[model samples]
Target: MPSKMIVSAASALCLAATLLPAHAQVPTVRIPEAVADWYNAGDKFVQESQKQKVNERKAKNVILFIGDGMGVSTVTAARILEGQMKGKPGEENRLSFETFPNLALSKTYSADQQTSDSAPTMTAMVTGYKAREGQLSVNHTTARGECNADTIARNSVKTILEYAAEAGKATGVVSTARLTHATPAATYSHTSVRDWEADANMPTTSVAGYPCRNAPGAVKDIARQLIEVSPAVRSSLKVAIGGGRTYFLPSVKNGANFFDPEYPTTRGRRADGRDLTQEWVATRGPGAAYAWNKAQFDAINPETTTHLLGLFEPSHVQFEADKAADRAGEPTLTEMTTKALQMLEKERGGYFLHVEGGRIDHAHHNGNAKRALIETVEFSNAIRKAIEMTDPEETLIIVSADHSHTFTIAGYPARGNDILGISKGVPQRDGDGQISDVDSNGLPYTTLGYQNGPGYRAGGRPMLTDAITTQLDFLQEAAIPLGSETHAGEDVAIYAKGPKAHLVRGSMEQNWIFHVMREAFGFN
Candidate 1:
């Protein structure tokens, strides 16, 4: 392709990005080199498809990876960023799960709303039943924030993890978010409010409007529910890992909380004077152990340990970009997933494990595109690690997202341009009158930005140079200032491989995921 044509294509892309909706796909650069690379990619996919002639079979184990809020744009940007990190042209790169033989798009709308929250979307994925926003395992028949225990109990949908455990299979849940957060908690807990992760976050006294206020021992916070297994299931989980340690601990007498001088929000939320971690270790008996840091987590012996409960932070785990700066030194998502897999490997009846890249959503909500992208790369790495350890013949692996964000990758740049860098191809003129990277406003802009978020600039967008836009602490520019980026109402991608993976095909309802997993394991 001629340089003039390439510049024109780039300019068109820039114009479209500046004008189109945030959910619109990034325009492509279909130059000869790009076209050749795509052809090679297509050929590779064709070859892989030709070789995978395995028949449909039942899965002995199931692993579900949730990249919370990871939509198409996040994946594309992450792929490019990962490629750039490895010193290559990023556009051609593919994350590990992208190679999964079967792929589908998940319609992530909740039963009550088009733009759903994590509680409903994740509950739908695990339970095969659509739920209302903020309700954990309960069906949409239940109201959000309702404290009606009878209604909640009657309407609660049994999750695939519960079914797996009932059949005597080992079960586990891992995430970068708190263990009691929406995604992980939906696997086992039945609650009408996703925010009721700790006692402090719950209503202390019963009001006339609430249903369970007068009942004895009828309601428990999400954190308590995770530690207190129901008598109906096996409850012999091999792994329960993540953050939210503060939610499990009681506040100190002096009113000081779990003191993390580094992270200001690392304060205890449990006002009931209960230490759930200790209770968990005690309930699991001799072989079970509790870990609060990376050193303790690393010392765990999966062969002998019947259960491993790791809480590395007061709240959500640090973003992958800030992992090194965390003095607490929590385990990475990959580390947690591998450890859980090893422990579950000791089970004779197979296992059901849910691993979440939960921090991706948090970063997006904060309008910190760099952390979200970094979190995605780490999530991809964890998926790749799991693929390496599990066999396709017996284990079913899936990678999916609950919903998308208003996050976008716009602003045309030349091939091999830095994904996090300011818009360098916004069309400037050199001394020779040739177009360059600078924008029309004589300012640089980030290649990645959000539709609305905390990063919005009141006066026109600033010319953030690479030095600022590319930093780990940088927040991408937003179209509005809402303090947080809103979730997008578009469908998210789901990829699957291994036994019965072919079931994930075309466009499907989010709740259909539970049916696919059930079919994969022959759980029903």
Candidate 2:
């Protein structure tokens, strides 16, 4: 005898408890087929948009031009010098690459040291890996006389040019230095040493008498590499012009005759017993032609000629200032680039060409700012030509330096002052104040000059003695005992334009350049 209401509540509670397990394990609700279809469609659209974005990033062609040992200060000095020459402000003397939409800072250091040389730095840019100084596109080893037994033999990496060629893109390499020089060599050759010119497999005894001590291999030579080995390189090279005729000519040749200066002489003898000029002409095919002088280079018809080889000088081309002063007969860097572009553009697919103002680095080494500035301006002109010829949308252009020089500007002076001379604002009250009585060229009275480092002098000015200015003046001062201006351990600027150039941001390692180029060309 429980109460009737209590008994009913108990029964209801038991019934609810029975359904709790089922409710707790309930399944998720299912959407209708139409709603499911809508979601799928939206996801597809998003994926397609992403795909389009990636396609737009790949550039059809790329051109990278490096000014070895050029840094921010170098650019500033070059700009000021160009402006002064043109009677304009420094801001008005913008370089061709200055038009780029993206800029980045690049760390220039070797694997072994903070400061870098051209060889390893160029290798890093081209190969996407760091290398020790003086080493080329390979690893260093302590073993001696161990042919094919180094770490380089084990690591097989692909070059940007090789990848581009595999993708059916055209490529070319050009430089004011020997075409086989470090920067250009990084594109197609690989070895443990940068100086290796002959192939290891080649018979050393046969060519021992010739002065080709650094032959990495037979095809390693600039001429043979472009014409014989690496079919992709040869086929892609529609235009090959620079100033390394000695490497291409016979060793026995008495005199260097760049581009048949006079009528061709058969005095030189190659190992194959072939005339150097004939070998060059043969490589170009029957219709293709060659030139060696300014007049001959000018006379060539880019419209009709399919291939060209223009060697203006026997050794490295003269400095721009020397060339401008009529001390040498050679085409300007701008002229060479213009001609190369004109000839290369005729191909069905666009071309990848490299142009260098190599003499700028040479002048900087000698601490000759006047020569460096002139060479830099000449380099800028070549860049301008490339910009005008190629469309921005289809091409990606980069301007950068391999490293930095120690040269810098110092001293307190008013605007519009000549850098080569002493400061004009020195106080006249005390004997300590030295007036710069010299005019524009920085020639000082008496032999006394500013000290630059140890045993070095800035042949004229006696204004500032800081690290940067001391280095700059030391280069200018003829009496300085130093061999050359030294390179600095500092970051350099990278200017970029065209498709995917927006990716260049913040400071980055020098090897990242190769990655950028790879992604831009869809190599990965």
Candidate 3:
């Protein structure tokens, strides 16, 4: 039989099966043997549902995985791409966290905005309170650019990491983004403006800006908070690994600008003349070490290193698709997660670790779905590594996104279709099943698209080809033109497993995640 006829026949068979009663007599039909195979396979899934059980014991360790801008559609596309890479029909594949028993939908709005930014969304997750957009950990009552250290202290809410550290658990923060970026910084730093990452980024004269110098070190930038401001962070943050080398180092060293070790052309960002990386190592005394490149990171022995600070790049780390091209070489998200687990596990007391696949959002913003999906796949690999390294009984693993992107998956592509290629599927009603889908302008459209982004063409859509669509640098089509893609206001998914993971069930506000984590840790 022709392939198109087979697909139509299969569709008719599925429709008939749905319409007929269990005992209804039907005309004799020649069904493939795989029908019985699928029936038995599906029955096993029904049996597995009966085995679901809840773990009520308190958790000893907690690991939070945030896939920035990772939405349901992104997960679906990445799962298919992952399976396709493994030589299978992509629909049946699952990301690592997708296998978690308890999952929920998180409404990701902030106190002031519907489509929120990472700063407030992350603050919600870490502090159990939703703040206005651009604010970190501080409550909504505070001004957007408040530079007063005392005012921030008065309005600041404690994060779960701080609680864990205060209770004697080791703490760590890891990300593919700058360590001072909103998502990772929310775990340790509080600020009114997310952009104030370094002393140089702060304003000089405004009443609400750059007053930290006159406040006698009362208020500091996000990078300084990681090293000198936060009590829990400075004293107990055992592992800090990610990019943003310039955020910690001073622009001046020995009376001249201090150049980045990895990027010689770029100097450090701090104007205060303090190298926070040096401070990070000095304050921790004997067991502390700082690494600027892969060689140094590889040499640090997790067992003997009580404190670790690794900054691989001056800004955000390379996307998974571009990591090989990085000058100084960078660690994969999985490698960082493995090293973090190895180091945090050394303390007899349990630990709290925050790992962000921060570059997924960056890729999406650039309208590059290929890199975004690849980053998500790497994020999944890191989650799998964490699961393999920790005991599920004592480790509460929660995976979620701070917010979702406008990235979308559309059209009815065939089961084994290339996720990044033009949409092609068996014809159902009026169209030919064998041809790629076309827009009103007669241009072939890919299955993947964006609501608005750099991919938008002003006049008409471009004719897409397999070679063009499959390239790593290709940007998918967008409906509306914008320099950068904006985030979607829709809710994101939450996947959890281990002690008290049952609390993650049902729809909830994004901030509820913090409460669940706190409860799992047995904090009063």
Candidate 4:
């Protein structure tokens, strides 16, 4: 027989357990004091800094590095992979931006939907307004069909780059993908659709096929807008480095021999004339140099180079793993970032540089965990280098993903786990009455795979796993198609440092990133 007090307490506990949800019933584990102290320190620092006045005269430089599809789990996996490669536990290698003094979580939904694409997602970060999934700088009121209308009365939002440039700061855009791609373009260009590249046609005439207000014969391509019209490029942007030289060069010059090799024609040029690259160079002073290869990029001196247009590859540059494995002509992400920062920081009023690890998104789209993890780690290295170069007080450095991938970890084994292998200790039994085992590269005791969603799996081995588990599975159970994973609708994390970084706290909408930057730069 129990004591009266013990019996009463047991009865209350039983009632509470019965009332709670199944997931909530899991016992809460307290973190160690040391770890808790570290977290509390960060929180207190953020709160204290937020209360202080931001002296606009003190801070001048701002650098934003976006790992397009890198979710919290993606960062964890990358850190682990990097650590393992260097012969240490995954947790030993901290991400470059992980050490930021201020941290927050960002809600990444678009205006029209829960899950987000890069177009509106990046647009929200750059423009401070949520738009439709495919739209760029324009708000939800603007229709996709009217994207190219010159005089259409639509609410226009200024991008961070635009604001920074207006405030007399140098701007630069660098990525591992095309310069006209969604993430990079959002900084300066505005269009309803993210995919309308050079070849894609835009709305020219009205619904009746007649010319309407501010309507042109055809819509201007994104590439042309960036090179010809964007205030970032046409006005204050001094260093524009990344891939996608094909979009700028003439067809023959771009290695497309449709026209005469000697007389190259610019692709999709209605009235802009051929030789857009030449025109862009002319816009820069006489000393502007364009380099399409590593040798040319290496030769350009930061002191002498007034303007540089570096397009290292014909298309989206190779994945970090592919580049590292091959040791090819392409420059590393860190190298690109270093060069861009070096050149931009030389400007007197400080600079706004956008560096992106664009391939991380592509890797997740392909369901290639290895490639994604490697690219993510490489991106982290770039961030680490930036941290080493810039001072925390003068520079506000932020590293965040535009959105999250459906990537998840499931099927648990022991603490040390390998992702690319079959799981063991599943409930399903073998005919011989022996515990079965599946072997691959360092056979993981648990299958690191998704269950049913966009990419579904039926009647396969199963082990204990979920969102909160400590495994290396990349995709979620909800992902179907049995091939690639999808993007997650959950809020992503924001890591920040430097003056006024304390503003990022609690869960925030993605558009708040624009405000954070605006506030940090004293634009507000």
Candidate 5:
């Protein structure tokens, strides 16, 4: 055969093999070197697909991972960024949860609003019901900031965490945001107003601009609910770790307020003369532990500690990019997750754990795509670690986002282009050796953009250079000017695996996630 004809035959064979379904057998023929890897990758997928069988056995444990504000665009960008960090072309990379066998799209709108907040979306996922925006686990019947305990009790729905504890299973909650923040708070706390995180927050205008004035004990702040009010939290919560430390302590008083353990200049924010951290230890009695810094957190022995509470910051934990600069070190999301799993592993009846990469939402709101993607990568790392630490057969894992940000990834850039940098079209350079792609103003624009955010320039769009847009603090360009970016009324992706994970298939309401979990555990 002619040399050219031999090459053509091999190329054809390679093309046919690469186009076959992942599980299909290929002809026994030599293939070109370039497409050899493609064949191997498909074969691996084939093996994995064959190994995956329907999991119908009741799950003994459950782990719900919420990546706050991680919309579909955020996931695609993060996947690319993570791959690029590993020195790859990036479009082929998948986050840990992306590999889940059962996938679905979750409608994130709340009962009262199309674009939703974390409180209601998370409440929907945990309580099997959509709720009003800004509310916690309670349903839509209760008004926002309703202070009457009787009304709240009637409207409050049981969360999966509560159901697990009632079934004699251990429970845990971990986040990079304040534990009292909407996502993790929905797992255990019930409140009409999410911002009422502490007694000090109750007097704000968002909550009627007055004190709770109901019967003295009719209403309690979110932090207090974690330590004293929530029966599931107080009795069975083996691990509670996150930020928002000041919310648990009282304001400065001769004998009431306590100085922050880590920050010299910061004091507790609570108006009530109560130290909830002390109360957590005292109420749980022996084997209970409290940690405020990385050193203290590292010292906790999960085997000996029956209950653990860790508040790592005065407010939200530092972003992953800035964590090292924290005066008193803070644990990463993966570290917190590892510790929570360790504490819950000993439970005989199994456990239910809620983990939130809460700062992802905050970074997006701030119009900081770099930090948001970094948080998402860290969140993926945490999920990877959880998969490694659990028995897939017994532990059902569900990963999702509460809602989406107005963030977007646009611009027709070539493959392997920097996801965070200005878009460079195919062939990158023009005939005159200038960059090929630019806006009407002849300025380069980022592949990343936001619908509205602080990144908006007051005059006109600024000329974007590679160096400027690639910086860690660079805010992606925005279309509309706003103090902060807003949430979008879009469907978010859901990934699930383990027992009964098949229930997660198809487009579903956000509240359906709770039912899938409930069925996984065979909960009544």
Candidate 6:
């Protein structure tokens, strides 16, 4: 049997909503789940469930937001935190897009792995193909890191973004991570290895440059491919933004590219003397612009510019919590999303934009749930802003997670308990009399936790007060002590609104998301 703590803690956490509120002003945690509503036999639930059954004609434009590792648990906890911060009864509150007309759950399993990673998850979302782990835009038959020409030619699947572009729709990608990271790269490039961001990151022999020794035409380092990529039927993207400035610069014999305005400590990763940024700028032609700072980026007239390339950091952009303090003045994810939409919307045919809150996964990997929650909060803000900028009638907005993490909202924290705080104030029934059930370690535990991570505290000896437990830097206790927490195999929720939104009602495979977009847009 599992440890009593595991089973008991889970049951107590599930039952926590029935307990009193720790903070008197706020209400108890509402059972937002479907089970309670089903039992209640409420008319509202029935009416809400029945709505959005008819899928409308294809949308003119599509905007998909992928919140990496944003599991249902993360969403629930973040929902509470967002509400509590605003002085509301957290459990009853809703994020901006949570009220979206349609909702469904996505089963996030890859073709080759029970638990998925960003690469294959993104591939599934964009291509409607369940790819193997670490493969982007390639089918399951292709082996990871295989640079064989025949395999590459046979397995590369066409993505929805490419489909939109081929149909004469404008296309753009924005992220808060290196533009070449797995999530964003899946939209534009096909590669077996997720780590090949630049030439320096690729192998000199097997992983050798774009058009590898074995794969003469397909396999290539991500950044090189990004700069050289041209859609098969349409012109290249109208806009691209995010970090990885040094990856585009040529190699320096000594010292880093501190001289580069946007990336001071960023060393050039390309051994070749090619300036890919300038080359990309050249391809964009007369009205094109390349920006490395806020001023340069802001100066670009969105109306006139046909294409804009921005690389603010030498690597991934700072997390949302630290973005405001960026020394190089990087754009926020919302800023990039807004700008890309402003430019792409001007096109006559329509647009497809992929915006990723890419750092949520990063924060979770480091066992920092607070940062992950805040990142999710920021991502919610981005969705609201996108809704404000676009037309619902013509645009299809879908918000979903690439995969989930091993995070949990456990422990019997009282109603409206600080989402980041320890469980307290709930008295559980013990045999004949009630007792403030304390653990063997004689300490109260937390409401939030991880299945396994660096946050593990051996023996669970150290008890925590609300003051320390609620701190932003506090780490939720974990069951195991891995350097990093791993992704979970779970069903992530899909929240959608506007055009073809009705099609997203039932639980479906991860690749079903891409097909929904295609069917909504009436793409063959």
Which candidate wins on lDDT? 3
The residue pairs found clashing in candidate 5 are none
- Rank ordering of all candidates by lDDT, starting from the highest: 3, 5, 1, 6, 4, 2
lDDT of 6 by residue, 1-524 (tens): 22222234345545654574654222234333433433444656666777645547679889999998999998998999898889864886788779888899999999989998999999999999999888889888776666655567677899998898888888898988889999999998887788877767766556333344223444667888787776542264888898878878877644443245654555677766667888887876788789988878888889999889988887778888887787757777878888998898888888889999988998898888889989889899889999999888889999999999999987666567778877654444321322223576677777788998889887654767778877767777888999999999999999998888988888889899999899878898
In angstroms, the error of model 4 at 388 is: 1.5
Task: Compute each candidate's TM-score over C-alphas.
Answer: 0.88, 0.73, 0.92, 0.77, 0.91, 0.86
- In order, the Cα lDDT scores of the candidates are 0.84, 0.64, 0.89, 0.69, 0.88, 0.80
Segments of candidate 1 deviating more than 4 angstroms: 1-41, 206-217, 232-234, 252-267, 426-442
Worst 10 residues of 6 by lDDT: 428-437
Q: Cα deviation in Å at residue 142, candidate 1?
A: 0.8
- lDDT of predicted model 4: 0.69
lDDT, residue 25, candidate 3: 42
The ten-residue window of minimal lDDT in model 1 covers: 426-435
Task: Point out the higher-scoring one by TM-score: 3 or 5.
Answer: 3
For model 5 the local lDDT of residue 357 reads: 95
How much does each candidate deviate from the true structure in C-alpha RMSD? 7.2, 21.1, 5.7, 10.0, 6.1, 7.7
Clashing pairs in 1: 424-437
Cα lDDT tens digits for candidate 3, 348-408: 8899999999999999999999999999999999999999999999999999999999988
lDDT of 4 at 206: 44
Off by over 4 Å in 2: 1-56, 89-92, 139-156, 197-223, 253-277, 324-328, 425-455, 458-475, 478-481
Please say which candidate is ahead in TM-score: 2 or 6.
6
lDDT for position 350 in model 1 = 93
Candidate topping TM-score: 3
